[model samples]
Target: MSWADKPNGNDMARRAGASRSDFDGDFAALRQRGRHLIAEIVRLSRQLTDLQQAIGSRRGAPGRGSVSGGEPR
Candidate 1:
């Protein structure tokens, strides 16, 4: 290889810096996505709890389409 083709200290440092910047950006994006997913999971959990309570209340009511075993056939 030519002497000019050899990567010097400054060139290597710049490449390392660019790679670190890219990694940091990717990590931040992943963390943000994870937080959003966790929030969605919490919201869904609350909705499920509410639906279960509604079903439980309906089970004791008369002629409201509530089945016997609480399971669909």
Candidate 2:
């Protein structure tokens, strides 16, 4: 393209600034979403750990009879 077809320096600067603003906005939104997902993961992990512990308590402690092999001698 001819030089005249190219944007002037001021126009180019404005466009660059706008593009940078868009990127910054997008990154901010992404970071917020990441934080939300991390919180959700932590909450779910805690719930699962609580459930596992509850189930384990109901099953009683492991004993020789609970082993995979036949009854202990």
Candidate 3:
């Protein structure tokens, strides 16, 4: 019930630092996960661009495949 029963400053700081280290490690892991997600986003964007380009390259003339045989109605 006296001052001796209460933890000292050094003990409190050490405990705080121990918990702080766990938080720091968690932050580091989250940061790495964010980096991986960003990289995946960039890769997906590149894939989308490539798909758009491929589609554009494969398109035929406007009236080529029409059922009307490209003739005027």
Least lDDT summed over 10 consecutive residues: which range in candidate 2? 63-72
In the range 4-25, model 2's lDDT, one tens digit per residue, is: 4645646766666676676587
Give the range of the ten consecutive residues with the poorest summed lDDT in model 1.
Answer: 60-69
**Considering TM-score, where higher is better, how would the candidates rank from best to worst?**
1, 2, 3
Instruction: Write candidate 3's Cα lDDT for 1-73 as tens digits.
Output: 5334645546766666677676587568668878998999999988876765555444642422433233353
Per-candidate Cα lDDT values, in order, are 0.65, 0.62, 0.62
* TM-score of model number 2: 0.58
Q: After superposition, which runs of candidate 2 have C-alpha atoms over 4 Å from their true positions?
A: 1-18, 62-73
Candidate 1 lDDT, 1-73, residue by residue in tens: 6334645636666666676676587568668878998999999988876766677576654333333446553
Question: Counting only residues 3 or more apart in sequence or on different chains, how many pairs clash (N, Cα, C under 3 Å) in candidate 3?
Answer: 0
Which is better, 2 or 3, measured by TM-score?
Answer: 2
Between prediction 1 and prediction 3, the one with superior TM-score is 1
Candidate of highest lDDT: 1
